[model samples]
Target chain A: MNVLNPHLKFQSQSVAKPYFVFALMLFVGQIIFGLIMGLQYVVGDFLFPLIPFNVARMVHTNLLIVWLLFGFMGAAYYLIPEEADRELHSPKLALILFWVFAAAGVLTILGYLLVPYAGLAAMTGNELLPTMGREFLEQPTITKVGIVVVALGFLYNIGMTMLKGRKTAISMVMMTGLIGLAVFFLFSFYNPENLARDKYYWWWVVHLWVEGVWELIMGSMLAFVLIKITGVDREVIEKWLYVIIAMALITGIIGTGHHFFWIGAPGVWLWLGSIFSALEPLPFFAMVLFAFNMVNRRRRQHPNRAAALWAMGTTVTAFLGAGVWGFLHTLAPVNYYTHGSQLTAAHGHLAFYGAYAMIVMTMISYAMPRLRALGEAPDARAQTIEVWGFWLMTISMLLITLFLTAAGVVQVWLQRIPEDGAALSFMLTMDQLRVFFWLRLFAGVGFAIGLVCYLVSFMQRGRVPAAVEAPAAVA
Target chain B: MSETFTKGMARNIYFGGGVFFFLVFLALTYHTETTFAARTNEAEMTEAVTRGKLVWEQNNCIGCHTLLGEGAYFAPELGNVFHRRGGEEAFKPFLHAWMKAQPLGVPGRRSMPQFNLSEQEVDDLAAFLSWTAKIDTNDWPPNKEG
Candidate 1:
């Protein structure tokens, strides 16, 4: 049909390979930072005792955002060309984007270590310049401006690709989710004068990103990739994607209630928060349906390398552990007790890493091997161990989270006194909290080992045989 | 009837879930606001609650104290104040007593400051405490100790 179309000669996947490679490198960075943060909880003065807790937290949070963003950017770059039947507008721009992003990420981290406010003031000119009062996590205006510019450049490249290219359900959902990341991040730039207002707006960035938009990015990307790897019909995947999007918006918009439960908003907030937040499970449940159903209906043998199986499995565990457990505490009544405790951390870890981070890793794992198609078929035995590693890490993390939640409940009950009773001193309560943190540290180590083994397995890719198959349907 | 059932089934499965959940939200909200407040007769003690509300705000208690399990867990749950400290009578005296005894020599834990509240303020704060405890939280704060 296209006798002279020069673009038709190239494969859709050719553009995506570089994105996959970059994501894998970022994944390594993310896990190492996570291990350090987990260990610091157990031993107070680990990794530069000079760095304050807030600075460590800033590094931890910022690293997660960067790596996850890299993963998402790579996945979109890789997937859009595959699903949309078009080429990226410019490879040179994409490479330039990588260099700029890398520079920004490094500078931001260094800025964080040097300053008390996560390098916000150096970026912005704060006249009063409270270097480190520790009242709130403050940053300079320039740092905020810098982050905004970084987001704009990345979004512009992706946006132009999507605009000039065709739109599929997957791309549309991804575009919406990515736009959300840019929109919500604006709130992170400034300190709110009113603490209550500050918290109220802060969740607009943190809670909304995690519970709301991130799920959209996660669900769409997972479904799109699974569809490509497994030979699922486009119709079926599209239907599943729609259901997830519907569920995310329903649960996500109202799910902001869970955060409001303890921020002294209103008694009404608890009921509103719990009921809507309860529905957060619906989309995730749909995801489990999508995965098992797709795998079940596969007409051909799946390319069962370790990355394929483990990446797919990440979807299932994330839905159950992060979505369901998260719902348990969504109720204001329960959150009334659980907020700000290890219980909250328990949900955050699984929901953040398991649901959000796992999806990113799943994409990278699936795409990376194929991109490197240097006749290196991944070894079956190595793949098996890596798949096992995924389960081990996920299960260990979930166990640690649940244990911390139980500890938090105990802390709330024991520390509180009857209105007419003697109160427990704060010091006494913290003494009891040490053991749980230690337990979390142990589980974290287990999860970290699983991560290490999985990484090691990635290094063992052999050669793809000539008979290795391509995706069945191009569209 | 089968065709009707087919159409009805699809409609109900989707819309029904929404309707059912919405009704549950309403029922829970009503039950919380109405049932226990009526039984406790604690609503009549408005003055004490007003005083307590003032105290809670003036001291930025939400900065530390949690009501209905909301706010900081820094202090104990005050949602069940009346039952926790014995009764309404014990509530005021208890506040007066705790306030007078400040800077308890507890090691490690944060110390509560002495607010030096007047006797009337103490009574009002206690009444507010009682009022909050009487609200039907559906058995929240599972233990009386906290």
Candidate 2:
């Protein structure tokens, strides 16, 4: 599997190493808290007063958001410089902003755990501009302000680095995504007295982030990887990135209507949401076709087998998770039965893991070895362990989604669907769900084990492997 | 075959398409905002309702209970609790009693901590929820047992 090096200089890329390390550490923390939450779902009070379900759940969800942001930031720091063909504008600023964002994130999480919710709200000046307690965006108003500051600083750094050097399509697209992320976040500051309006704009932050600009980021990252690993023409890959993201925004923007169906918004949302979101999977499907086609047509096989595996895994699973499964319950009629059920949970776990988490890890997989080996590939044993980790986590996640989907169906029938003159009480329906919850918990343990393997894989040191060059495509 | 798509076209589409759809989202948002007034009958939102909404946020109730099926799924959906419990009369007492029985000391069963809410605070919280129950959620929860 001997292969050629990328030929690019390496010092600028080394800046991304610390952020990746931090994100991986936070990834571990997220999984630990996730396992805790999974147990509480069944045990009713696993940690009880000490780390109540709410606190644990907050930690779990917040850690996920924080770590993904870390990944994105790391990816930008790593790739933007190379795409621009220059060193970062300021590595010192990147490091400083990293600590600032990380510190704010930690303090906010501690606030959630250490003080009572009400007391914490007061202590953090939340009442001055109340923005706490919403899902996902539960940071205090000051914390939210800090996020904006960090984001602005980040965008400035990336923007300046790209400005001084050649601006490739990858950098441009990634910049657009990062800028959109910052802009959409402003909606979190708007919490009017109107709950309907609050929820409406709240989707601007949540839905738009995942479905809208984030797709641009994901597409560009995938494109960069494809170009490097497959030796595909940069022109071929960049054009595809553009087309894929265009499809994404087209369907994804109106696709936000899907969330509006039952949220007391206009009746038209039922129609709009269903129609647009149904098309949301198109871009993801295109991504799959593009990846496999590129691999099949590879001019050279990259030495990083783990990176290739992750890239393909991300494509296939994202389609199934965010695309197919999302479409399954996206329409108003089906959502009526499945909204807020375990079905949504099922989609969430897979979609985030497949789309965002895996892509970030994909970048890490491809880039980390280069960093460790000083521009050479990781050892075969290390790559094998990572490949193993990928399967264990991915398969367990699939099983978890299946169990949750099954639970959602049964719960909907018994609790939401009526029979004769009655529906089951929430508790009674939950009682029936214990079996599925238990299964999900088991799957979760498998996922945790996989995560440990992934972490250990990084530490393995051995003979570095020569790169693998793929057979040329037959004319 | 040569590539049919160009980076210029893709970049244009990215910017143009992003703006076009975001405009659509904004238009829909405008429609939702204007029509929401009639849907929610928000004129009924008194100071007490405002206070109740504050209480709901202060307590982080959404962390445990979902309102309008949007929050954590840890507890029963609180969006329709008012209607499910048979309106304000039946709901108030049940909510009060539920709050009083904190951590029910029942092992292997989920417990709700006592917020030690005042009587007025309880009334206001109930008011907020009842108001939420009245929102035009298109008959969500699919049944009164939400």
Question: Please, what is the TM-score per model?
Answer: 0.71, 0.95
Top DockQ hit = 2
Per-residue lDDT tens digits of candidate 1, residues A1-475? 2233232223444445555555556556656665665655555446443553345555555566777877788887777666666777666676776777777667766776664341244244453432221112233345556567767876786677778878777887787788888898776653333233345556667777877778878877887767766777776676667666666666666567676554334456577778778888877777777777787787666565554565567666777666777877677656655555556567667777777678877776676665655322255655676787787788788878777787777676655433324544333565577787777778877887887777676665533433233332432
Q: Quantify all predictions' global Cα lDDT against the true fold.
A: 0.62, 0.86
Task: Highest lDDT: give the candidate number.
Answer: 2
State the lDDT at A175 in candidate 2. Answer: 95
- Model 1 ranges with Cα > 4 A deviation: A1-30, A45-48, A118-123, A126-140, A375-377, A416-423, A462-475, B1-146
lDDT of 1 by residue, B1-146 (tens): 13343423432443344345436544643544343335345446465564455455444354335565544444555666667666855766777788788646344334455555678877777776776665544445555644
**Residue A193 C-alpha lDDT in model 1:** 32
> What is the DockQ of the complex in model 2?
0.69
Worst window of 10 by summed lDDT in candidate 2 chain A: A466-475
> Model 2: what TM-score for its first chain?
0.95
Model 2 segments beyond 4 Å from truth? Answer: A1-10, A419-421, A461-475
Each candidate's fnat, listed in order, reads: 0.03, 0.64
